[model samples]
Target: MYARISSDVEGSGLEVTRQLEDCRKLANSLGWSVAEEYVDNDMSAYSGKRRPAYERMLADLRDGERDAVIVYHVDRLTRRPIELEQFLEALDAAKVRQVRFVVGDTDLSTGDGLMVVRILAAMAANESATKSRRVKRKMEQNAAASLPHGGYVRAFSYAEDKVTVIESEAVVIRQFAERFLAGESLRSLAAWLEDNEVATVAGKPWRTTTLRAVLASGRIAGLREHQGVIVGPAVWPAIISEEQHRRIRALMQQKAVSGRRAPRRYALSGLLRCGKCGHPLYSAARQTTRRYVCVSGPDHGGCGRLTVVAAPVEELIAKAVLYRLDTSELADALAGRTAQDEALAEVTEQLAGDRAQLEELATAYADRAITMRANG
Candidate 1:
């Protein structure tokens, strides 16, 4: 007998045990020996979740381990019409002459029985769809009211109410934003969080993927998102400023673009820009020689192809970096800072700050307070 319930059936008083008892009684009356039973507890068949017991039972029937299948009801077996068709096919292939039910004795081996089963399955599927639509409508209404999702937000960074930020986690969130915007790599940040004994909302150590998700989230910036798209501003206070969020997004996009390009096989892939076409030069190795090539041809973008040996380019870059580290005053201050802070500074230097910074710089340049020669 196959008996399944999608929830705490005993607590809900669904009587799965009673269903099994009835099936056994029915088997006794028919003069058939009761075989093994299949049960799936707290598993929704209509939700399309895997029902291991149901699958195993089907396999057993196909392998001739069982000649007959019994269930409490047809809906208990399946709510999907497509699955009902599959079962019919499997039953025919297995040549199972009988399908018994506790509540009803239907000879399922006939064409008329199959049609009746299909119609029952269709009705079950319709009921499931109607339930799903109602649930979705309720959720939509809740979202429109800016209510906490699913009646409980339970986010790490936010209070149970969802609108109020938890100060401790909120502080960590701001630090995450600042560190990321400053240029700390996701993997490095994840490792640092682990080293500092910072646990995720689930009380697990941080991962690069998880850290990236947090950084990418607009919820920290007081924005509401539905299905991955930002719907509007959220009711909660933003942990990070809008400028910080914008800078983080831009940085993420830049990283994504670089990631989409070929993996850097050599060290000097990003240090050079094409003098001729202004495209970033990439490292390409040919036999023993690693060369930096500006691939901005007609095939790539459009540019005058520029190529240079990697050895000299790398040497120049190394010397410049070493010189800055050894001689620059800023480098001395960086040495005093944490690895995370140093990394952030590097990113800030690359990005030259946010849009407001650029606008301010432009204004200063126009006012002659910052000369183009000095700034460059």
Candidate 2:
């Protein structure tokens, strides 16, 4: 006996149980002794996802271990035409001709019964296709209206409704955005999240890929994204300003283009230069002691004659930096930098507005609401 239910939203196996009971009654009435039963709960035949129990039943049929098959319905066995054909081929190869359905009672021992099964499988496939189209259209409609897309878990920094901001998570998101913009690596940020016991929506520890996705998402900036493209403003409030989000995206792109490596392990790794060749010194360890040496090779293009002990150089540089931090000149320079940051923020906001306008025009063109020349 083979029983399968495509969906069980409540995670209850009642449908499969009912199917097996009907199949068992049919087998008893037909005077056929059942050796075993195969059940696939919440598995879709048309979805192309693996059904373990169904595959096991097919393996038994192919090996000639089973002389017959019984199911509640043809659709329960398979909704895909290709799968139905495969099943038929397996039965023929194994010489197991007896196939019974409790509801349809389609006898597979004759040619007419086989034809009927083929037609039914094709009809099921068509129905599945129609349902998929309807679902896609509904999703598109929801996206256009800036409605929250349904999912198993709520988005980070948002409540179960997907519109209300969770202030605690929002604060963490803001911290991530700010630190990321300040040149903190994604790996570093992930470590911080883990150390602080901040878990994801799935209650898993943070990873660089997951951190990148959260930081780069438009949802945190009050934007609705559909199929990876930002459609428009979202229904939810922004956790970080749109300008900050745009800057984060730009910085991420810059890093990707440069192919920058992870955070440096040594303080003076890239700071010191070779006095002989005027090239940067690469950090190397001599036995247990750390040192900076100029590399000699086609790749490095350095003279390789200069080498310095890392500890003393790093200590001197740290003292120098600390001294500079207290100087009046450094404070004056920082005041100037504050003004520059505000100007940069203004430019970033303007750039975001222009990009939004371009997106609107492109959307209008795609919808046939404007001419190509006007869009340009």
TM-score of each: 0.35, 0.35
For candidate 1, the TM-score is 0.35
Per-prediction RMSD in angstroms? 27.1, 28.0
lDDT by residue for model 1 (1-376), tens: 8887763111113357766876777677778886888988744545678888889988988998998888765767875766777887788899988797653245676544554455444444444434444467789999899886765426768877888888998888888788887778877777677778888777777766567667777888888877566788989999998788768877876666455433233444444678887766666777888898886422233264788887776666656654553554533332323224556445433422222232232232221211111111
Displacement of the residue 238 alpha carbon in candidate 1, Å: 63
Question: For candidate 2, lDDT tens digit of each residue in 1-376?
Answer: 9988874111122368667876787799889999999988645545578888889999999988999999866667875767888999999999997898764456687644565465445434444434443468789998998887875788889999999999999999998899999999887788777778888999977766567778888989999887566789989899999899889888876765464432223444444678988886877888888899998643245798999998788667656655654676434332323224556435334433433332332232222211111111
Find the 10 residues in a row with the least total lDDT in model 1.
367-376
Q: In model 1, where do residues sit more than 4 Å from their true spots?
A: 7-13, 135-376
Q: Which lDDT value does model 1 have at 338?
A: 27
Give Cα distance to truth, residue 375, candidate 2, Å. Answer: 60
Clashing pairs in 2: none
Model 2 CA deviation exceeding 4 Å by range: 8-14, 135-376
lDDT of each: 0.62, 0.68
